[model samples]
Target: MLQNTVSTRRNIGGTEFPILAAALPVVANDPVGDTYWHIRLKAATTHLSSRPGQFFQLRCPRSEAGDPFLRRPMSVYAVDTNVGEIAFLYKVTGIGTTGLSTLVPGDTLDVLGPLGVGFDINPEWDHVLVVARGVGLATMGPLARALHHNGVALTAICSYRTPEATIGLEPFELHGSVHTVYDTDGTSDIASVDSLIREEHARRSFSFAYTCGSKRIVSLLQDLSSQLGFGGEVALEQRMACGLGMCHSCVIDLRRGDTVESVRVCTRGPVFSLGDIVAPEETLSWYRSCDESAI
Candidate 1:
């Protein structure tokens, strides 16, 4: 369990008391590649209730001018409320993450969360098919662990562009059966997301399909879920500034029956039902552009 934990309420961004904190870091280090970092936060009482895929708006302590005011959003990688700790798996993309990467073990980071909607898993569903690409595995890992602890079966299909880009698989395999797919590497027999899904379906019936990765993969899973006659959810990677509803930076167009409506990713969802999203091409493009801009 985490030490020195306490809880307090505070107002942020015109919203009264949305965050709680222990305001300290328990773990911080670079993962295998420079592309990502693993951080564990010892939270105050309020951080205990977060669900998988929900995120926090993190505030980095500044040393110079021209730093951004609004906290940057990052998904909850793992939660151990008993220990008063929350884990984060984030890549160093911009000034926020770069500052975050520089922190030592004892540094304090201001956090506002557990924000955004998370994956909704049905208790009745015994088997879950998890389709992940790149860092999406971080968003799905804790849910896989929770479901596994509850006796639900987990089958993970992790896809990467190459062997070097592959991440978060070692821990995921601990919770379930893991199949790694590399597009340009010959380490695994499966090279594509579609091929891996077909392999899983050929073996057994999966009640739920959870995806968090590329928009192309999400689109594919939506079609496959309908064909397989199962419910599914997608965790979108959007460019979010506020991690709250006010900024309007993370908007997504969703289909609500015969009509389409726009929803903010930070508030309405970072996770959405497969049937809810409309054409995500523009949103996906925006994310890529923003992510590139950060780099």
Candidate 2:
């Protein structure tokens, strides 16, 4: 266990809290669907305060393939602040996660943070749409719980390789309705998801469209939000050596008015304002603009 570990206080967006390096007991580690593992940890009360969209850097145990050099970042699937539990959904891919998948109920794992800013829930938002695909389905649970707690209505669009591969439906369904789209059935295509989102929005206008798991889906939401006049947010996936912002490895450009500025995904966001994001097609121009500024 990460017993009696010292926590360092860091000021983030003006709030100072201890960033814990806790060794939490693994309460459960089991597969969800055929694609993902659902791991539950018995957390300290301080650790349970993580919000939806926040992630932790879990130190994976060494396995047959050898040591994973860095901790793996996984988004919070659920957090019960009162119950002292936290959960994560992740797939066993590559060296790190393969080791993660080997964990059992009796083990203790080292973890850091409730790192980075999480999704900002607008309590006034009456209706929200969440789009997720594959393992991204795991990232939606806590967000669903939060929206449900706020009495906000929700619609979740889950895309997967097959119907049986779908994950996280229970938490989302407990909070609101869920729509599954399958690649095996061609319903996971952008065009099909676009149509589905439009039909659902028409039935009940969404105040916000939030997405993770697919960039194409994020683009569709960005376009639709503009056309439909609703707010939008998106979670981005990036490879990180350090889950903290200090590494400069996970910096991404974000638009602030006419200027584009770099921000760390591990700190400023893994969740960004969909409207404020610099489009992928404009990346070259942003680099050029940065060059011109330097010159």
Candidate 3:
């Protein structure tokens, strides 16, 4: 029996709150690759009610000349109601993230969230599958926790660019079984992720699959879900100029019946049903190019 949490209807998209940086951001150095950081913030109980797959639009401290005005959209990694805190896991990939990395304990940040629709957790699901790559794991963590709390069995597959780049494995293990794959090693060839999904389905089918990662991985899972007869959801990544519905900057094509409609990623999603998403040809080509370059 899945136990539903309190409704967060009042707290959904467009809610803004002031959050205090609870501690100095912690950076984990990957011996073989780039560094990843985790940041926690003191938040109100209202803010802590965020659901899995939801994200925040964080306005970090301004630059020396007060430039880079837009807030950065970050996935909610975990929410701790007990401590009244919410956290995010991110890599310093650009100027905005770099500024976030410089934050110290007690720093104040303007947080606009828990924005976007979160993953839908149904009471009927018994077995669930979660797939993520690299920092995408951050977005999947809350869903894993929610499933565990609701007594649903979980199987998580995480892919990293290198073995050393993997972080936060222990927490996922605490919730359920996990398989880690690295691209640099021969491990990638041992058994493709799709094969594992097929194996799992043969053993005991999953009721639903949730994934957040590269477009290629998401597309693969979407195809697999259709083939195996299971529902699937994906959290998409896109560039955003505004965290609200006002900006069409983060629009993606979504299939509604026979027609494809462009929808804003910030408001309508960062999360969507696999069947509803329509991948553009250019995006597919870009994903293919990335794969080719990696090979």
Number of backbone collisions per candidate, in order? 0, 0, 0
In model 3, the clashing pairs are none
TM accuracy, model 3: 0.84
Give the per-residue lDDT digits (tens) of candidate 1, residues 1-295: 3233223333222333345433556555556575888888777666767778778878865533336576777788887867777788887766777777777777777787777777876777878898887777889888887777778788988877677887888656888898887766643332356667777888887888888746666667778888888888888888788775777888877888987777888777788888776754534435334332110
Off by over 4 Å in 2: 3-13, 284-295
Ranking by TM-score: 2, 1, 3
lDDT of 1 at 193: 60
Report the candidate with higher TM-score, 1 versus 2. Answer: 2
Which of 2 and 3 is ahead in TM-score?
A: 2
Weakest ten-residue segment in model 3 by summed lDDT: 23-32
In candidate 3, which residue ranges exceed 4 Å CA deviation?
A: 1-34, 63-66, 189-191, 282-295
**What is the overall TM-score of model 1 with all chains considered together?**
0.84
